[model samples]
Target: MLSYGKADVRNASHLALSNPLSKCAESTSSDLATSKLHTIIDALAFRARSIPDQTAFVHLVDGEVIEQAITYRELWSRSQSIAAYLKAFEPNGKRAVLLLDTGIEYVSWLFGLFHAGMTIIPAFPPIGSRGLSRLALICADAQPDIIVADARFSNARERLNDLLPSAMPQPYWVETTIPTGGPDCTGVGPARDDIALLQYTSGSTSTPKGVILTHANLVSNCENASLWMGDIRGRVGCTWLPPYHDMGLMGGILQPVYDGFSTLLINPGHFIQKPFRWLSAVSRYKVTVTIAPNFALDLCTDGISDAERSTLDLRHVRAIYCGAEPVRSRTIERFTDRFAAAGLDPATIGPCYGLAEATVLVAGKPVDKPFVSFHVDREMLSRGTIQVVDENAPGACPLVSSGRPAAGVEILIVDPLELQIVPEGRIGEIWVKGDNVGTGYWRNAVASSETFGGTLPEVDGQFLRTGDLGALLEGELIVTGRLKDLIIVSGRNLYPQDIELTVEETDSRIRPNGCVAVALDDGERERIAIVAEIKRSEKLDDVAQELLRRSLTAAIVAAYGVKPEHIHLATPGTIPRTTSGKVRRRAVRDALLAGNFAQYGGRTRAPVPADRSAS
Candidate 1:
């Protein structure tokens, strides 16, 4: 158990000072800002050649253990075969959509794509049928030359065929089951300026946007990430995040590969079912480096047993990157304290910052560096002023600094409307300009133009406008809030508007215009929840609740399919409303938690008359 009073003071004190690990105010010169494409694949191939019989990856399945160790010679030979096999389809072998679920095959194909001189578009297999369909739609729109998939997702090709009326004469499916060496086909890769990977954000909207990343962009981010993660070669990096997410695909897996290190991966579903297995894996594998969103740590702290904890050791983990969502101080403390006895180092918990648009990392600090924070007035924070204060000061909420920008990246805090750079300690939208920044979104010219076509008046350059709200406190980035209605639950972005629209369509009693979708932050944790008004009668309420629950649940499961943390039912017209008649979600949440819902006594609440014509 944590003493909030004590933790609050300590946390607040840390926030009042500058981050020790923050980089100097002086920026790197243009001449010093540099990158090399194909470093990761090249490094892996180099290692495979230098040490032919090294363990490359270890995979564990139900009661079965399998390890694939490749010598440099073997990896090179197989990559050539895989590349040759990949060239059987496209005349130019320009690009391929890799749908292989996580496995050795996936890793090999990823490596082979580099050797084959083909761009890779990775999609998660079990991202729900709807997510898969959405991916196919985007892939069709992008018009990749070939589709590489495991046998299980062969149906996706059919789905792709249905979604894209004019896909092509025939899209090729490179089965990863065959361990044929990577294709030996030789073709000059597109310029570093050309697209290397296309990653789609979770299907937040009907038509998902694809983040277009160039080879130079990804390679640069990976190299910077390696520096932030320290020299990881010859170390085992453990991971359980899904291989499709930017943080997982690029940061978790690719960073290790970039550093020429072997990785131990477990499927996310298996870990979710048994969160403790994550710790078990770390101890069993002696993983020296790993990364996870804050929630995974929360799960381990909440569910791991002291008895089981005693049997494990996480000391080898030099740094665990906490990102992919808002970094909360409570989460960090809880995890550190809980695992302290298990040889987990509290200082090794590195709270970093990143986004999909940045190819994952925008800012990070060394793990051994003490966490930094700043306490400012929430009201002042919203007004764009970052006034640091004592932790015990009334109305002071501590904000954790996401450290300074990564080595080569430049971050600016600017007013959203004016594009004027805000002064130090003033909150503003985060604008990032760097080689690691993506080219633009796939087929989303409108969005791309809006996000990347802006010039910061103070910075005097183009920057990718991040919708996130933050500030620069003594040169370190302190993210405070988001300007959008994106709900982040357990490190995944959940759009409330999407869920509200889903519910409104199917539930008749859900006053379409009277629903408020908001995340409830109950001091300790946050979750996506909603409140909606219905008829004010016991029978009506019961009927509405059950129908709304079942219908909304099924609809959400079918569509985006993530289960919201909770749902709330309110009496018709009782939910808080704005002057213009818009539902006030924050107010509704305040009222619901306060138990201020009104009792129903109107006509809608009265029982129907039962008497027939005078008997």
Candidate 2:
């Protein structure tokens, strides 16, 4: 049974008399253990009754300092009050877009929507014209009934007025700070099958799609994550991930609340400005679990100085979940080697894999075990085979395992075209099925049927086509790359990430995670094209730029046996990326074909072999 402090029990009894709808008597520790808590609202109510004063979330600034905190009772109260305000707009079972910046207000509004039985459509506020246009696209797609924003963003009202069409149904705008006090509001908890969130894809590979996630899906995924990560009740978590993304919303924000733990939250901008604060917060708060993408691990390793590293103590951290993008083995090695002195355990590094369609965690390694990788022949991997080899062997490529499927989740490697399960070690499309898997895309029947209704011959259950290519070796999932992103050259399959990583490693001027490899059809055959982002330094002469181009082309040929016909080097931040940080290779390819970067004139054809080494 769950444990509660004596003082909290007393406070719950008093609070229950004031608000009878909370049903505090029915949410005892025994009931919490037996009932699944269908919706997040129920979970929050349970916690409020059991641990009224327990810290739910804490926002931190620089130097690992807390700027604000919210207790379980306070969170419940504020969310209920906000829910009452939203109900006046008749938002019951309707979609509400969130435009507020990340903070306590954002958290409160999210829960408030849940309490009011409204579907949530979380989005980032626009920064400029480009951002406003993107927001326009999302609003057009979602067609929300209401929009919730913080009044602090002075430009939000103007931006919304400009982007939203006059003829379209304008959503009712509600400011979070403005209190609309009325009679005591009663919470009508959402049913298990009700739509809880309409999470939009990050649009890295294609246009964004609204994924329909039900309350059951969210609850199931959180329960599975808790089981996989061990008992997290009352544990601490830290994150600097954006609240709009799945990794942040589900893992960083919701999971802690569902598991009855306090989270140390930091703004993503703050962490990017100073990566050391992430680790320092873990040390200061004894954060047991945190999640980040692969690039964040690299940032912590490269951005932190030895002087700062010496002051950290991360022994209390049990798991550092790495996902959202491709996990690099070298990044993990570098981080562990650099921070071993700071009490970081090698086993604490957990490589995880999931998507917005799965409500976050689909698979993750156990926190007690060290990360695992397989060294396979590079040529074999390119040919769609996983042949294990020695690390020092010629053309050896290291493939990191994304761990086994989470509890109650099943993963199948199936041929994309045939929809049949493939051999265990053969690379194929990843198919997943579990209670955590979302039902379908919002209002998109064709895509929903094609993606969420995938069937396996002679199998009884439906599976989600993950669009990712991977193989299961010894029961561990090794994600290779996206099925659509594979570059086919001379009958060999080369992953774009492999080529991009090689290009970045070949030159110090090339920005890490800023290169994209794409295949262009030359009417008869598909030719390779690479768009690499370089750090803007001194202007290079035409001759020097040509020499740099040839060097990169020759390196690609030597590494993958495929020479890129066109190589375009652009300034930093030119390559488009999703909010979660996955490179938008398709968008970059389109921009390159359209000659978008011709003004900077970084494009160059490969020089002859004789002039390749001339610098």
Please tell me which predicted candidate would have the highest lDDT against the true structure: 2
Lowest lDDT sum, 10 consecutive residues, model 2, at 19-28
List model 2 lDDT by residue over 1-615, tens digit each. 111222222232343253211211222123457655888888898888877877787676442443566788988988887777776776678989888756666788899899888999988777777667777778888889888875655446666667777787877777666464554567554789999999999988888899999999998998898788885433678888999999999988898778777787888888988999888777766678898888898889878999999888888778999999889888789889999999999898899999999998889898688888999999989878788999999898788999999999999999998778988889999999999999999889999999998897688799999999999998899999999898898899999888888888888777667788887765566677777776666466677667878999999899889888877767777777777778877876666666554323445333312212111
Please provide, for model 1 over 4-79, each residue's C-alpha lDDT reduced to its tens digit, 9 standing for 90 to 100: 0111122223422521111111212121224333544555555555444554555444211333333335555666
Return the TM-score for candidate 2, rounded to 2 decimals.
0.91
Off by over 4 Å in 2: 1-31, 61-66, 152-154, 536-544, 598-615
- Local lDDT at 605 for model 1: 24
Q: What are the Cα lDDT values of the candidates?
A: 0.64, 0.80
Evaluated against the true structure, the overall lDDT of model 1 is 0.64
Provide TM-scores for the models.
0.73, 0.91
Show pairs that collide, candidate 2.
none
